[model samples]
Target: MSLARRSLMEAAAARFGWRRAYGDTTQVDALLTEQTETAYSEAADHAALATAKNTDALHLQPCVLDVRGRVLGDALYLEGLLSGARARGLAPELIERLEHAVDHGHELTVLLADTVRTTTAAHATGH
Candidate 1:
């Protein structure tokens, strides 16, 4: 993983209450890289299979329909955190950027979860 992605993941994890399990930078970097690569591979495999079956549109229909609901939930979650941070009188610019990042993270989380769930279901049903 690139330094930027690793940093972003670390920050997002911290924001979401994921503690650092490894104290050393080397260990943390290795873990993050491994986990990210695994996730990417899983997502790619899911996408390839879905494409091969021409099921991408069908699988994504729910997400497309619920886009607004998902975004609103993510925004409210982020806004609550930002409001708390702001109450502490922290830097406004940093809070704004963090809120944006959190929203992006939420989207990624939802997409990844959907892909994983779809792939798992396909495998279980021998699809």
Candidate 2:
């Protein structure tokens, strides 16, 4: 996870007194695969990011991961994911930003869930 993402998760956890986020990893993995592929095909943002990553590293799988991460790293995405992660919150900004991402299967919900879980684990064990 990036430092910025970790910080965002930490901020949300502290602000909301949230516990560890839990979800079905198998489902998440499947969804991530399907949605990521879809994003790669459909989302212009993903193409641009992937191209940028390719130019940066000229690698393969890692570049794909970076593209997804970049899409999820958007402030609007993080905000929406963070808000949805908690029991009570919603970000209008995120809702507005969703026009391109969710429709394109960014799997942002799964990303948020994973990010929440990572943050929870870090806080739980003092890692």
For this target, which candidate reaches the highest lDDT against the unseen true structure? Answer: 1
Q: List the residue pairs that clash in candidate 2.
A: none
Query: In candidate 2, what are the lDDT values of residues 1-127, reduced to their tens digit?
Result: 6747865886889899875443888856865786678777788886776677644222443444555566656745555665564434346565555544554545654664465556556556755
State the local distance difference test value for candidate 1: 0.73
TM for candidate 2 is 0.23
Please provide TM-scores, in order, for all candidate models, with all chains considered together: 0.44, 0.23
Which window of 10 residues has the lowest lDDT sum in candidate 1? 56-65
Which parts of model 1 have CA positions greater than 4 angstroms off?
A: 1-35, 53-59, 66-71, 102-127
Q: List per-prediction Cα lDDT, in the order shown.
A: 0.73, 0.59
Each candidate's root-mean-square deviation in Å? 10.1, 17.9
